[model samples]
Target chain A: MIVAEQKPLDEIRDLIADAGKVLVVGCGTCVTVCFAGGEKEAGILATSLRMASKLNGNAQDVTHLTVQRQCEWEYLDPIEEQIRQAEVVVSLGCGVGVQALAEHFPQAWVVPGLNTSFMGLPTEQGVWEERCAACGSCILGLTGGICPIARCAKQLLNGPCGGSQDGVCEVNAETPCAWQLIYDRLKAHDRLDLLMEIQPPKDWSTSRDGGPRRITREDLRLVAEQVE
Target chain B: MSAADQVPLQIVAYCCHYCAYAAADLAGVLRLRYPGEPKIVELPCTGRLDVLEVLHAFEHGADGVMVAGCLEGDCHFQVGNLNARRRVAMVKDLLNQIGLEPERIEMFNMSSAMASQFAAAAEEMTARVRTLGPNPLREESVS
Candidate 1:
């Protein structure tokens, strides 16, 4: 899921300004799962903004609403009424959700309430660690389910860099050596032979190389064109 | 309550429906008196308790808060009580980092049969809040 962290309270105050009506939109899927831009978080942010606005002497009407998935257009259509009424929309979602809202409502100003951190999962309660980079490729098969692109500080595909010390990255001892873990996992699987194959330089074209990539599934195509 | 007569503490209690809420009701039925300063909010399950919600409660006016859930392995929702417990710990760390006392937030696990335990927990939280005084958020509001 997309992981995000709430921006500091003081920063949020600057976004709303003296705007009288503001809509705080939350995503119920990824952000909610990660405990960042979820329905409950939206309510809290709205309430906090309201309290802060009151404190500043100029009251603002802040409404909180959550969509099933803020990245998709279909899920956000339900909030058209609220979005149209507000002077600005404060998105409590990740970067994707904020951009999607901006695209959906071109006239309304959109502000992000959470900092889009990374694609990750909760290792335990309240602890979300990075997991994927969406580099437009999959290398998990050879590395035992962990992606070097996201985990390794240097994104090294081969065995541990010379900087790895005592199973920790030299760049920062706090970070576990990502490649070290990959080497250990592959060794345990008895597939040391896989390491011998020099990984080709990653192709950047399929990723952010050619602007934003769009996928169309011809097999699951909607028949909306037939209605015309 | 007037500032002079006020208890100088405000607490928010998150009571789970299956156990803690029942215990609170039982406390009422048993006529076991406790501090009136603690405000109670009943939830479906402790697992549904979100850290943001707890922070929101505190930001509004709560000086201290407690998550009252079913005993471990006894939650109606299986592991919701445990989830709430974990979140309360995170909330405590976040609170402490922000200069609020870690003692301001707590988690109590008990079965519905433990009505006396609920009262005792309330008393304990109330006393702790008294020591900490009112929430800084409330202090800021008044000043």
Candidate 2:
């Protein structure tokens, strides 16, 4: 899931300070699961903003709404009326959700209420840790299912870096050395011979270095000529 | 008249059914006297409490909020009280971040047999909130 944390209340207040009417939009997907931007959070934020503005003697009308998935256009269509009525929108979704809102409503001032942190899963309740960097490549099969790109401090492709000590990363003693984990797992599976293969350098172009990435599936695409 | 002279402080206490709620009942059975300002909302477990519920209490003019659950290591469901404590701490941080006093909300751990402790918690929280005065939102509602 895409994990995010709410921005400081003061910063959020500042963003909507000029608007007379504010709309707080929430995403029901990733941000909801992470407990950052969900229906409950949206309502609480709207209430807090209203109380804060009232205390400042500059009371503003704030509305709260949550879409099924803010990244999808159809889910956002239901809120078009509210978006049109609002002078400013504070999106409690991940970065993608905020951008989607902005793209769908160009005339409305849209701002992010959360700092989209990373693609990860909850390690435990109220705790989320990053797991994937979404590098547009999958190499888990070669590394005993442990992701070096996301877990290693240096994103090393092959063996453990020299900085590792006692199976712990030198960058942070608390972090388990990713390569050490791979080695231990491979040894248990009797596949230690796999480590002897010299792997080539990874292509960085598949990642963000190549600019914004898009995946087009011809099978799923709706051809413009089909409707006619 | 000053703001303090207006409405009495309104505090909400969410008590777990297995412990704190029964403790409150015991306090009443013993004829123990505690502040009457706090309105009790009984729950199956404090673990089920959400951060939004605490925030909404403040939003709806609650001068203070408290969550009373089973003592640490003695939850009826094993970890309900512990989970409640963590969430209460989170709510306190959120309250402080929004310019509200963190003291306005608190969590207490006590067993159903600790009737005196229940009354003490009520008195302690009531006095603390009285000193903190009414919630700022109360003033907004009044004017």
Candidate 3:
């Protein structure tokens, strides 16, 4: 899921400094689980902004609205009245959600309240580790379940670098060498022979196709004739 | 003396029902006299305390806030006091970001038998807030 963290309070304050009315919008999907930009966070941020504004002698009205998923237009459709009421809209969603709000409501000035960090999952209670680079390709079958593109510091495909020591990556001591883990797993499965088939430079054509990536399913799309 | 001390101060103390609440009750029973600035709001546990609740107190005119929970390792709910401590610390950081005194809010832990500690906490927070003056938000809204 997309993980994000709130921006600095001063930066957020500066973003909405000129506005007399501010609305905080939160996404209920990925950010809710990560405790970044959920309903509770939106409420806290709205309250904090109100208090901070008052303390600074800035008279401002701050309110909040949270949608089930900010990335979808239907989920955001119901809050049009709330969004229209504010001079500035602060989105506590991921980068996609922020852009969705901005795109959906052209009149409202939508500003991001969170710094969209990465696509990762929570490793523990409060720890999150990146797992997928979304490179639009799969190499897990060649390697082990561990992802070298996301887990490895250098994204080494062929084998571990010489700098690895004691199964730990030299790039980051905390990071276990992805290639080492792959080798160990393959050896356990008696498939260590796969490593000998040297992997050349990865095909990144699908990942970076010169522009923003998009996919359209002809089966799901309808034509003007069908709409008529 | 700071200009803050010249104005009236109101400090809200959110006390856990299991420990700090009972401690404050014991202080009252033991005829302990402390500053009356700290208004007590009882909760089931400090873990139940939310950042919005603390901010609500400040927005509604509180000059300072004190979250009183069970002792660090003695929380009846295991990590309730610890959670309350984290929330208190978070609120302090928020206050600092807002140009307010981070010392305006604090977290204290005590058992039911620690009446003296409860009174001392009250006196300490009262003095601290008095030195800091009335909440700037309150001053801003009033003007």
Instruction: Report the lDDT tens digits of candidate 3 across residue range A1-228.
Output: 998999998899999999999999999999999999999999989988998888777778999989999999999889999999999999999999999999999999999999998889998999988888888888999996878999888888999889889999997898788889999999999999999998989888767654579999887878655653
CAPRI-style grade of the A/B interface in model 1: incorrect
- Could you give the candidate ranking by TM-score, starting with the highest? 3, 2, 1
Which lDDT value does model 1 have at A23? 95
Model 3 misses residue A14 by how many Å? Answer: 1.7
Q: Write the per-residue lDDT of candidate 1 for residues A1-228, one digit (tens) a residue.
A: 888999986788788895899999999999999878888888877877775665466778998999999999999888888999999899998999999999988888999999999888888877989999888888888888768888898888776788899999888887889988888888888877888988987787877786798888977997566664
DockQ of each: 0.17, 0.54, 0.79
Q: What global local distance difference test value does model 1 have?
A: 0.85
Name the better of 1 and 3 by lDDT. 3
Evaluate chain B of model 2: give its TM-score. Answer: 0.92
Report the number of clashing residue pairs per model.
Answer: 0, 0, 1
Stretches off by above 4 angstroms in model 3 are A224-228, B1-7, B139-143
The runs of at least 3 residues in candidate 1 whose Cα sits more than 4 Å from the true structure, single-residue gaps closed, are: A141-145, A209-228, B1-3, B6-143
Which of candidates 1 and 2 is the stronger one according to DockQ? 2
lDDT of 2 by residue, B26-119 (tens): 9999999998988999999999888887887887789999899998998888898888998888888878766788999999989999999999
- Show the colliding residue pairs in model 1: none
